[model samples]
Target: MTRLDAYLNRIGIARPSELDAAGLLAVQAAHRQAIPFENIDVRLRQAIPTESQAVFDKLVTQRRGGFCFEHNRLLSDMLAAMGMANRVLLARVTFGDPPALPPLTHCLLLVTLPDGQRMIADGGFGGTYCPPLPLADGAEATSGDGARHRLTQIGAPGTLPGEWLLERMGPPETSDGRGRDHAAWEQQYAFELADTAPADLVMGSHFASTHPSARHVNCHVASRVLPDGFVSLLERQFSRYRAGHPVERREVADVAEYRDLLAREIGVDLPVETLDRLPLWAGAD
Candidate 1:
């Protein structure tokens, strides 16, 4: 029998016996607090895992962060062991410049609770909420991270319809002695309720992590949400973004600081051999 207690303990899911909305929130909190969304394996030339056990061994045992494949796959397994029914949904993410990427590059999960209600459970997207969102159109999901996010329906249900967009209103940037106030709502990703296997995700994720043109392979930036601000490590500089304001950045002089930040904030550790190559991912040194 799959042990729910052990898995919950590993992920810090506290209140499994409660099995109510509160319990769901607890599970989501545990996941966000314990697991980190990261792409360190790409620098190490490690093979992205394809099984739930492999993900558990890499994350729980080895203490590492992973891309969507490993992160959500293990999370889904944990949820299933906890007696929750969930569906794996595929999404394409657009982050940096263009805004949204094409479909099939991201993965999310839809969870069905005992009350026959559906929620969005995601642990792989860095800096996202720990709890699932009510799978209802026009419902807003506010996270502990201070981001006001809502899901809007694009098309009719069962038509393989619209996107679940995550949006935020932030202060505008002031440059060259000019001040501007504006609102920005970008689509993180969109997906339908479809089941995706771990093995399948691994194959596609491998290409994205290794492809020379992919944004992830080209940038060494990693971020995690904090109560007061967000910590982002880009190359040697550590930046802090707070409540939609100018970022505070500092250059890291010692390499140990980089490793320590990964361990402390992002919940990851770099292998000894990969330490020298870390700068390669950061496009530094």
Candidate 2:
């Protein structure tokens, strides 16, 4: 089968007759459900190959999960195969109130639909819009997994820059250590509709995957969007959410537990030998 057919099968979706909003949403949700965001290879100290075919082989043929670079590379490539007009954009992931400024290391898509409307296809990120997010500023959309999201422009009035900030409706921080009652818009990431090149993604992935202190390299990270919620594994801690609210949490004890969770919850099945590369997916002791 052609890679496109394989990809559609992998995502458990038939090719959309017309690539419109509904079709895009279906693909986005299915993609997230099937291919989780993960960094096992990076955690294993393997060099992340950023080539399109390499990513396709690992994600589609091998039936594995990967991080932003691998995820969006496959999406952008599939959109091209579908004859959709889309381009890749790099963004700085700011999970709201980041202790330090981050660099642009996230990948997303700017797709011009047939009707001339634009949407952001972020197939990788967790707690993100399930459909391609609408491009209009201040317009809100509900995600497939029950989360809410919207875009806001940057800069002064009438002098809006190309950069767009993405935010999700989440709980407000509380000083009492107990959760607050009100919901607030939290910054997720920001990106510009500027031209991005393939090399840009490769460069970013190289740094993130190779840098000794990078988060992915230091811990176990994986996430899969559920039909009604989400499940994430990070820093040896596993969390499950329902309706965008946390419902469960636990720490993975050993490699066996990690392997089971990776398979049962996150939809990834690594070989025993591969799982041995990281004893506990831990950081500094």
Candidate 3:
């Protein structure tokens, strides 16, 4: 089957009848729902290959989910196959709220609509902002999952020129219950408008997958955006959020439950035995 056909079928969405905002939203949302944002292979200490054929084989033919590099690269290719104009841009992730800037390790797809509007698909951030938001300065959008996000152009981080900052509305206060007014808009990432070079993506993907301190190497993480909320697994903790509110949080009992939870809530299936490679599971009770 053609690449476009296979992609649409994998995501369980028919070809778009038109090339518009709604169409872009549907395509992106469906992709997020079907293909989870995950770091399973990294956790398993496997090599990460960003090449087209390798990514297509692992994420598509093998029916597995991957992180930003793999996810966005495949999405970019799929969009191109569907006659959509798009480019990949690397970004510095800010999910941890670090004191200083992080490396440019995330991949985001920027697409030009028929009307000249540029919509950005979140590199591999599932369960958070799934819809494509306009790349324009001060562009604010609420995703289908009801998560609020705003993108604004600003001076690039750490002595660079200009770049855009994407922020998501996070919880109201700090985890310690320190009083903070409204649920603040947390910085998600920052990226320049320029198209990322192929070599840069290769290096970035390597850093994210093989770096000793990278989150993927240290712990397990997977997320899937739901129709009305989000479901995610971080290390051993499993969480479900609804309408921006935390509804459930608990530790996964063991590897068996982890595998079942991924299939039950996220719609992504994997070999149960391979999951034992994770550090948490590698050790005996």
Candidate 4:
């Protein structure tokens, strides 16, 4: 088993164990606070590894945040080290301005406790960690913050019995047919228990990073959740979403300052070669 103290300390998870709801919340909070949700490595020529040691080296040893595969894989390993039984699953992410590429897939973790209880633990999701949703559908789960999120079964068996959906109830906002208002929330990601192997994500990750059509190739976006709301860093703007409030967007002027924030605030510092790619977005100004 991996050392729990080292793993928790690496991610700033101060809690003793993430076995219950409170502990789970602490783990999520620490994950968002410590590790960044970034695609910079993909932008760089750095190849994210699929093996456990390589993942640990890249994420824990190197102190970097990765996409779904890197984050969930490491998290799963950490849980295992903590003597927790867990499984890995894959999901096709449909985010804001969804990726146009074919294998724009995602990875998440499913953990089962000794009591036959199952919960979803995902520190990989950029800005949403409402709570640990039960593996069973039609189950309503609420985070410690009082945000109500639920999982509902989506597809039928003999096809994808593990298929499920998620939704959260938030504040109201002006609608634009993007599903509904801010209060209505939206479909986060659709996932199932199809038993996706780590090898599958490796191939997908390679394609995503190398393909010119991938979203990571076009722009830069880094997001991490906070106790209240969240903070996101886009091309030249930093947006903060506070609890019970709309998102606050700020334009960053200094090119040097933007790079500094990417390193300091985002926690995933890019190398010199990767830093040179910023000019591609100069026309946006």
Candidate 5:
């Protein structure tokens, strides 16, 4: 079978007849739900090549997951193969405590649908929108799985002209009485619609996958979007979430159990030898 066919099978979706917004949403949701966001290769001491074919091989053929660059690059290539127009974009991650500034390290897509409407299609971010978010600033978009997100232009003092911020909107209970609740909506990342070349992503992926200070290099991070909520594995801690329900978390116990959880829960299959080599909390305390 062709790589496209393999990818479609991996995501458990058949090719759609038309590449419209609905079709785009279906594909994006499938990709997010099927291929998890992970950094197992980094922990295994394997080099992650930023090329499209390498990414496809690992994600589709080997049944492995990857970080932003790998996941989004593969999705972008697939969209291109299906005759859709998409531009790769980079963003600086700011979701962490104290926030990461500068050196745009996250990769995503700006796709023009069949009807000429532009949207942001991202399969990499764990807790963001599933269906593509409309590119219009201040316009809200809801994912198929019920997550709400929006985009807004950031102004002044370190923000560039046209720099857009993608924020995740909290549910009603999390909102304060005032309309302007900083705690109500959280900023996922800051990015501009400026063109991002392949080389830019290669450099960004290099730092994200290998740098000692990079967060991915330190922990066993993996996440998958579920029908109701989400499943995530951080270091040895595994957590499951459902909308309107509390987060359920547990310790992974040992390497064998960790490997089993990856294969069974997250849908990633890694060799036993490789799993044995991975350091527990490689860069974390």
Candidate 6:
């Protein structure tokens, strides 16, 4: 079978009759639901490859998930194989307090529609919107999971000069208790239209996976976007988020439970030996 066929099968979605906006949204949503955003390889000390084939083997063949570099790279490859126009773009993560101005540490896809409009087709960002968002500044898009998102342009305009900030719109009530005001907009990440090369992605992946200060190095994180809510596994704790409802959380009792959670809920196939070697909930309280 062709790569496109393999990808379509991997995401459990039927082949689209046409590569229009509707088909793009369907494929993106299916991918997010099937594949999870995870850093298990980094935690296991396994080398994370940024090459397209390597990523495909791990994600599709092995049924494993990866961070942005691997996830977005594979998505771009699938889109190209299906005759879609796409480009790789880099982004700096600014999700935390006092937003981090780090180097381009995230990779995403910029897809061009037939009508010449650009859309951000990202399958890597955990718990974010699923459908492709229009790249136009101040345009809002909602995902199949009922989460709202938008993009705002920043800095001066030129050939990829200004950065685009992706913001997630929170719920109207303050019951979530995330310490933010009610109905606040959270900054997910910032990116530019500048061209991103494969080497650039490799560098970013290397640093993110191996750097001592990187959060992925110390924390084990896995997240999957579901139809009605989102599921996240951080260390040994698992949390579920549903729209207009309180976040539900619990801790895994032991290593077996953690492994079962990864395999059953996150669709990861980590070997038992690897799970035995790695620390499960070392630093978590």
lDDT string, candidate 2, 106-131, tens digits: 87898888888888898876434445
Error of model 1, residue 220, in angstroms: 1.9
Q: lDDT of each prediction vs. the true structure?
A: 0.63, 0.75, 0.75, 0.65, 0.76, 0.76
Error of 5 at 131 (Å): 2.9
lDDT (10s digit) by residue, model 1, range 42-79 = 75566778577888888777766676777788878877
TM-score of each: 0.81, 0.88, 0.90, 0.83, 0.88, 0.90
TM-score of 1: 0.81
| Cα lDDT tens digits for candidate 5, 213-244 | 87777667777877666777777878776676
Go through the candidates in order and give the C-alpha RMSD of each one to the true structure.
Answer: 4.6, 4.0, 3.3, 3.9, 4.4, 3.1
lDDT of 6 by residue, 1-285 (tens): 877788889999888778888878888888888988889889889899889889999888888888888988898988877767899998776665433456677878999977787898997875354468888889888754455777888865442323788877654221112224336678777888888777899899998899987768877888787766677787777777676578777888877888888888888877677787676746544
Q: At residue 53, what lDDT does model 2 achieve?
A: 94
Candidate 1: 10-residue stretch with minimal lDDT: 170-179
Shift of residue 157 alpha carbon in model 1, Å: 7.0
lDDT of 3 by residue, 1-285 (tens): 887788888889999888888888888888877888888888777898888889888878887888889988888888877767999888887765656667887889989887888888863764255468887888887765455778888875444423888877744221111113236777677888775778999999999898986667766778776666667887787877666565688889988899999888766687677776678776658
Worst 10 residues of 2 by lDDT: 172-181
Of 1 and 4, the candidate ahead on lDDT is: 4
The Cα error of candidate 1 at residue 33, in Å, is 1.5
